[model samples]
Target: MTINDIAARAGVSISAVSFALNGRKGVSDQTRARVLQVADEMGWAPSSAARSLAEAKTETFGLVLARDPHNLGVESFYMRFFAGLELEMSIRGYGLLLQVVPSVEAELAKLAKWRNSRSVDGIILVDLHVEDPRVALATQPGALPTVVVGDPSLAGGLTSVWTDDAESMRSAVRYLADLGHRRIARVAGLAALAHTSIRDAAFADETRALGIHGELVRTDYTPQQGAECTRAALTGAEPPTALIYDNDVMAMAGLTVAHELGLDVPGDLSMIAWDDSVLCEHTLPSLTALSHDVVAFGSHVARRLFAVVDGAEPGAFLDSTPSLRVRGSTGPLRG
Candidate 1:
């Protein structure tokens, strides 16, 4: 409830508690962890009014999603990732300020306002673009501590945390190739996203190297678009034998589309999903998927932001890739 209570419970000096709670220097990491743990156990929260009067640290991190708000709430990966980010930030006595904007410029403007007003201590940037203006804005000298989520190449010198999407893409294509899937179609996420671009290029190169016909169908990360893509793919004169989707939502839609078309999953049509979620398991024919710990990825990104706030240098780091998880939805090419 109070700092005194936390100090007494933590068995540390009140000054130590103050330093740890304020994100200031002069406390050992162990001591800081102890103070925070005790504070959380004692149900202590810093008063916003009190924070304003002190050293000007808002103790908050900013995250902006330049996507449709409707989808973010329902998307399993983002939902889980957000939970992980909030968990870490809460343990560190920091709040998360999340916003959704429709345009890149608007997102940049919001970040600027937060910085100018000192409304947030740091920020997490996601979905790096091929020619991202946010990169330059975020990586400038004396800029706010930023952790960009995507490939390091897109970050323009800021701290970046990325998964090995290129390799993962290659692995997916290779897996299909091994299953005798010569004609493959990938239902990719937004075209402008750096990760999507990476996956596209890797998929093309890998397919070419393996002597397979690979096509990429772009979408806006919507189930409708996914269904449309699947319908088009299946109705083509030379339909692909195997299909890969960028997310579980789209993959499930694709599966439904296959069923609607009178196709047998893994018998006439093989399918794979990018992210492993509950949806992947609930389908009549469970989806084979490229899976990884998305929650852990979020925690890693959040910790990188904290490190940057603690004055660590900006650099790129790789998170774990999506490992292939074969399931009922994928099988050898069938005539």
Candidate 2:
């Protein structure tokens, strides 16, 4: 229904109805409440196009993933994260525009187009790189309000939401070392991502400090690559007594590779996975993992982007440090 009907039923002028409906100042609170109630009873709904035109806002946010879309189907982390984002955005009467591109260049192009076309009010950037061009683009004068989901250092002055991945990596390595694993290997994700680099350094430093022989193999965070890396590491001469995987899918794959090679869980090999999920709990041996509230982390990022959209200064927010959850998949290293 129209505001004219609401004004007539509420016994208020059309200007007063306009003020109350649009949250402008020219109406009393009691009158505004009455007008709103009457509008609701009359089945009044604001036209999205008109509202957007009046406010000069699209009321939408954007996110671009520069990775294989197939990986998102099996990766529980992104699913939970998206759920959290949707939760926050829906409550705020906002929409999310998501794009999955095969390369960083394509992702940048999409972001540029969104900004130029005014398709979204803000942006949430993920999978940050060490020398990310996106950071520069987001920092340009008159750029859209952007929040980076990565370490503060990688954000380049943009508002950022991050977990302590480096510290978590060190904790995982120390836990394995404490269990008498002198030879350890980590099946890492892509080498270019900023968090991956941070984790790699932490793994190397922690293992060296503990006098452990640490090996690292990089993959694309896919099950196929994970399986391949696992087979190669497990079949090498003097195989590691313990292994750490960057994500749960990789760890699960490694477990299968261990079984194929006649290795026993925590008996001949111990393992740890990052970003724990239901799959980790249901695995035959129940994987030990680095666990954090990924859904909450995503919600926190959305909140920061909203704050930035509301004219807040750029800053960093630390979500959490992933803690280790021990399970049947990891234990004292056996002889």
Candidate 3:
């Protein structure tokens, strides 16, 4: 039911019902209780849109992501990340307005709505690219308080929450290298993504530092493309003895390819995946992966955004560095 129904049931003015439903001041405590009781009895709820109009802030943080929302089901990283974000939001009595946009253009338009309409107090951005438009828009004074999830370069004047992909990548690579792996290759996600570039650079640097040859194959973040890239890598005359994947989905797909090629994992080739997920632990042979609290990572960004919403300094929160968690997906290289 709607607010009007609740007001009628409670024999109160629509404004009174509105204030009560929002836990806003103006109505007496007893009147608020009466309105709430009527709302509960009638199964009525106030509209977030209405609340946005009444109160300048929506009491929500907008999360703008460029990935397929449906992919969230299989990606365990998001599960933890969202939980952490929610944990912080819940404690602060704020809510999350999550939206999946098709492109950066659409995302910007959506953010504009939230800003002009005051539908959110602040925003958290994910999937940054080099010279992204979001960075440019966020630089404007008195724009929506923003926190970016990746790459400080694109963060511009906005607050950022980043992971130490360079150090973590070096550690993961060194883990395999120390295990005697050589001729390494990496399965990279969308080349345009900032994190992909970071991992690519780190992988190349670590390999060169260790004096081993390294190569990278870029693909969209999909299992099918991962399988195709895996086949190409495994079928080469001089195949790499180990592969480091940017995400667990691709690593699982690569593992399937390895089985098809009759190459025993770690016996013939080693594998290490970044951003540990449940798939890493459940996969046959269990992937050796660079693991970190990515969910906590996301939550940290959310809290920083909340701080900005509360009038904290802009661009005050900055980088995060992810640590390594070793598992079974990698092993010593064998000729």
Best by lDDT: 2
RMSD in Å for model 2: 7.5
Report the C-alpha lDDT of model 1 over 146-191, residue by residue, as the tens digit.
9999998888888999999889889999988998999999999999
Q: Global lDDT for candidate 3? A: 0.78
By TM-score, rank the candidates, best first.
2, 1, 3
Provide backbone clash counts, one per model: 0, 0, 5
lDDT of 3 by residue, 258-322 (tens): 98999998789888877777788998889888778776776787788866654456564544555
Assess each prediction's global lDDT (C-alpha) against the native.
0.85, 0.87, 0.78
Query: By descending lDDT, how would the candidates be arranged?
Result: 2, 1, 3
Window of ten residues with lowest summed lDDT in model 3? 48-57
As a TM-score, model 1 comes out at 0.85
Q: Estimate each model's TM-score.
A: 0.85, 0.85, 0.81
